[model samples]
Target chain A: MIELNHVTKTYPGASQPAVDSVSLTIPEGEICVFIGPSGCGKTTLMRLTNRLIPITSGSISVDGKDIMGLDPIELRRHIGYAIQQVGLFPHMTVRDNIATVPKLLGWARTKIDARVDELLTLVNLEPGTFRDRYPRQLSGGQAQRVGVARAMAADPPIMLMDEPFGAIDPINREVLQDEFLRIQDKLKKTIIFVTHDINEAIKMGQRIALLKEGRLIQTGLPDELLNRPADEFVKSFVGADRVLKRLNLLKVRDAMMTNPVHCRSEDSSEKVLEQMVKNDLAFLIVTDRDQRLLGYVNQYDLRGHKGHAGDVARKLTLTVSPERNLKEALSQMLSYDLGILVVVGEDGRIQGVLNSTTLCSLVGSTYDEHGGHWGRITAAGRIL
Target chain B: MTTYDFIVRNWPELMSLAWQHTVFVSIALAIAIATGVPLGVYLTFNRRLADTVLYLAGIMMTVPSVALFGLMIPVLSVFGHGIGTVPAVIALVLYSQLPILRSTYAAIRSVDPAIIEAGLGIGMTRAQVLFKVQIPMSLGVIFSGVRVAVVMSIGIGAIAAYIGAGGLGQYIFNGITQTYDAMINAGAVAVSAMAILADFMFGRLERTLVSKGLRRD
Candidate 1:
């Protein structure tokens, strides 16, 4: 665990401290994001943890040892760091860049080589194709991935990332974020992430610490900050549409209806229609005997059909994964003009159903708890 | 006689003079590189001092090579080495300092700060960052400076014969006194040839020494 007790840094001759008296603890295997507008000391706070910038006052301890007491060079080796510019050495190839920390720690040549290739693969870059290439040859997203790989080269227990994906375009940013989250799931390093983008903080941070003018305004889970902002500053910073932003934090599994009414494709249409009517469902999901999704039938298709439901069921063109965020599921529904989406597991088995009404109610319940009239109005409009 | 004919007739004499001239310039260059490159690197950590030292080096370049050689005679005579290889070499070394030092300073300073920051952030000591990142990145530019120094030294070393250093410049002085056009032509042609050859060879050396990753194409 990393702990900062009453940290304050006032650069020489500066009137205001870059980081005011702030205290925070980051537990092992969790990601805590520091977010605020530019010049809010989020970046400064992260730099102080690694001793990149000296702390004017207060103390920062990583893994229970004070940073100032440790040799700065040796301390930095065990703490991974990545930044927005990537800052890759143009003179080194991708392999050498990732092997920087390992080489510094004096690892064996063979071990360093194997570790370099392993990290390249972990970041989703093929070692064979990328290991020999220079940083200038890579696109922005590819460079950022290599930056992350290099930071994790020594497998340090702590990592400090300053807007690591801030330079990529929107589409690639989302892709990189998802890829990083997937990697983080397995590695579980205690990470201090700094960014100005709230959406990124919500997506990546397990706990979000909001800073303003070198002071932390609020610290809590993404949902807490969105649903119950600390003050008007946080409410405005998270934006007025925080209720919608909450959808980005929640997943299809969190809001999806489980055990949705379904039937065997080989069942008679009359029986399928009876099941749909009994469950008050407009459509019936058709599955094979093995529980693998085949297709789905609506009441309109079954009303006039006199054969097996499998013969008349339209192809299920749209489906969502239970692991996806609700915002994505909602977008897919809107894009396809779909009222509901079948949530499927990796094995192609139907897991749940996410419809407009379920999403509206899920958002609506939160509003009811907060007594938010605006949220209720918005949720009602979305349902219709 | 034509320049080519004079060169052929005195090929052995010409080769010996060229060899002596090469040695004279090589010694001076070795000393300059050893001292100047490090001095340049040192100056990078102190900007105010760098400006002063670079300005002084630039002023040294503006002095005429012959006049500088003339000044070295008086200075070296105190050590009983006036008007020969020692004084001639001292002048050439001083002349060679600007290019080598200036290039090393500029190239190393211009290395992307972000790259150095990353190097340090990833746990490299200051010395390691200098050797592994800064120096390698600066190699291409520093080499070009050395190439300039080599070519310039060859041209200036011919004039060193005036101080009795004994090189290709001997032919020029002797030919002028004896009014022998063939001897003068031979010396001038050899000097130019040596300079061109040094430049071409250093270009190839630069390609090999600098990392392939730094190459734009």
Candidate 2:
């Protein structure tokens, strides 16, 4: 675990401290993300952990050892670091660069080679394709992957990444972010990630520290932060789409309406009508044992069918993944002109149906009267 | 022997003398680059003295190379020297400083502050950030400055011929008074070739320095 006890940093000749007296405890193996607007000390706080800048007062320690007392090189060796530009050593080839920290620690040549190969595989890069190439040979996203691999070279328990994917194009950023998440799950390393993007913090951070103008605003898990922000600064910082960003964390299991009424394609229309009437639901969601949605049959589509509601069932365009973001579901609902979308598992098996009301209910109890920033919900269920 | 044959036979003599001018200019450029890069970097952290120091460099740059060489003669004479190649080298070095200093200062000053922030955020020391991040990123621009300095020093060193400092310029100056095209062409070709080679090498160095590729900033 990393702990900061009232640490502060003031650049020489600056009018104000860049980072004020702030205390924090980051648990081991948790992804702790620092987030805020520019000049808010989020970056400064991260810098202090690595002793990139000297503290004006107080102390910061990791794993019960004072970081300040450790040699900066010695301290950094134990911490993996990746930055926005990647800063891969241009003078070195990719294999040699990724093997940097291990070499520094005097690992055997074969051991370093094996470790480099493992890291490349871990970050989803083809070792054979990238090993001999220089950093210049890779694209922005590829370079960042190599950067992360280099950082993980010695298998440091603590990793510090500052906007590692920020410079990548949006599409590539999403790819790298997903890949990084999978790697993090497998590694379970203590990570401190810094970014100006609150969305990134929401999606990537196991815990987020929100800072503003050199002050610690709030630090909490993603859900707790949205459900109970410390103040107005955090609410606004969370942005108008805070509700949507929060939805990304909620699974279809958490948000879906379970035990939905079903009708089979072979069942008679009269049979489906009785079932819909008995269930008091507007539609009978049809599915096979595998739960692959054939279509949904509403009261209107059922009237003309000779067979059961399944025969007249209006084919659903597509199903959403159980892990898909709530905002995406809302978009699909509008695009398909349907009140509900079937939730599917990785194998396209229907988990449940999620309508507008069910999703909102699943998210949280409305506290609009408490006078929060999200005063309206015009974007379907989004409290914009 | 034909005129061309005689010249080609004596080519070693001409090139050997011209090689001294190349050595003289190369030394001057080395001194300028070594001194100028730090002065430029110091300007970044020591902002208060930036303009004043830069203005002094500008003044030094403004002096006519020939007049500056002449002025250096007495200074060198007092310092156990004479009106010869030493004065010429001092003048050429002064002429070379402006481009290196200007480019280094401009390139580093314009570097995206975001890149530096990212560097520090990831645990790199300030020295590491400057040398590893900032300096390397600014290299393409800095290479342009070094190119200017090298070319200027080499071209200007040819003026040392006036002080009787032996060089390729000797042939060209001699050819001018005596109307010998062979000598003038010889010096001009060597001078142009040196400039082209310096430009090409620095250009390639710029590409190698950018291992991370062109950053968004």
Candidate 3:
């Protein structure tokens, strides 16, 4: 457990403290992220966790012991750290760099080699391809991964990361973040991750502590924090566009328009139109035995066909998973040149329809005053 | 018609003397690096003593090469020392300090604090972090300084022949006294070659080692 008991820090020239007298406890195995706007002390708090910057007043403790009293080197040994600007030694190869910590502890050559190999695998690096390579031989993301492997080498229970993924490209950042989250689950290490992006915190953090100008403004789970932000700063920092971010998190079942008007591919246009009109929907999803969307039919497509609904329903060109990121649904609609998308289960059963209006509405309501309080169904069926 | 032909005809003599000049420079540089790099490292770490150290190095830098020899004469006279390769090599060594010191200071100071924290955080002691992390990271810059030092050492090594420090400088100084242009030209060209060779060798070493981790593959 990591605890900050009224910790505060003031730089020589700055008038105010970087970290105010605020207390917080991060339980073991929980990924607690500190997030805020620029210069909001989120970075300062992470710096304090590792004693990178000295605190002007108050104390921080690890596992109920005063961190200041402990030998700084010994304390750091059990706390892994990585930063946005990865500073892998330019002269050392990937293998030697990862083994740096183990070497310091005077581990045997064989032990360090084994640990380096283990870290290379853990960080998803190909040992054969990357081990003998120097820092210059690796790309930005690869170097950062090496940084993580080096940090985790000592297997420190507490990990402090300051905007670790901030330097990578968007696609790479997403890939790395997902991989890192997976690693965290297995390690169960208490992590104090710092970031300026709320969406990242929500996606990766088990709990989040939001700070503003050196003060702790709010701290809660993603759902709790989103539903009810503590104050204006919290609301604004999480921002009004959060619903778009939430779309990535929400299950298709939660956002899907269930009981979609259904028709068989062999159904005639006239009959499909009747069902579409009855359901007040222009489109009817055509399904097979397993409810797979073989096709779809719009009321407009029903004008000429005179037989059963099955005769006119066109085959669906695309299908989506119920658990897929909702953004895919929006993209699927645009890609298929259709006004709606079909949500399918793992068994290929059509779960429901995703209309453009609903997708737009889901992405737009991030402005809601109470977000994480989503347990209370609002008038729009939006979680408050 | 060409000096290259003249040198070829006098190849045996010129080659032997060129070997001597290389020896003179190598010894001088080894001494300078041994003394200068450590002093610079110490001065950089100790804030209070930095001004005094800089002032001392500054005074040494401003002392004219020839005047320094004259000044050392009396001191050596009292100590009863001979005036040959030792005194001349000592002068060249003193001249190589500024680049060595500046680079040593810059390389250490410029290392990112975060990388150092990561090293220590990984359980490395202060010494290990310095040698393993800080030093290697700064190798590019530090070696560049070493390159500069090597260039200056070779170039100045020719000057030591003034005090009978056996080297190529003797040819130049002797040629000047006798107004023999061949000796002066030969000495000047040989010194330039040494400087270029030293620079090229160190540059390649820097790229292979220090720069390997700095450049993205």
Best by lDDT: 1
| TM-score, every prediction | 0.89, 0.75, 0.80
Task: Compute the interface RMSD for candidate 3.
Answer: 2.3
Kindly provide the TM-score of model 3 when superposed on the true structure, using C-alpha atoms. Answer: 0.80
Tell me chain A's TM-score in each of the predictions: 0.83, 0.86, 0.83
lDDT of 2 at B106: 88
| Number of clashes recorded per candidate | 0, 3, 23
> Could you give the candidate ranking by TM-score, starting with the highest?
1, 3, 2
All candidates: DockQ: 0.69, 0.17, 0.47
> What's the residue-level lDDT of A283 in candidate 2?
70
**Judged by DockQ cut-offs, is candidate 3 incorrect, acceptable, medium or high?**
acceptable
What's the distance in Å from true for residue A9, model 3? 1.7
DockQ of 2: 0.17
Rate residue A313 of model 1 by lDDT: 78
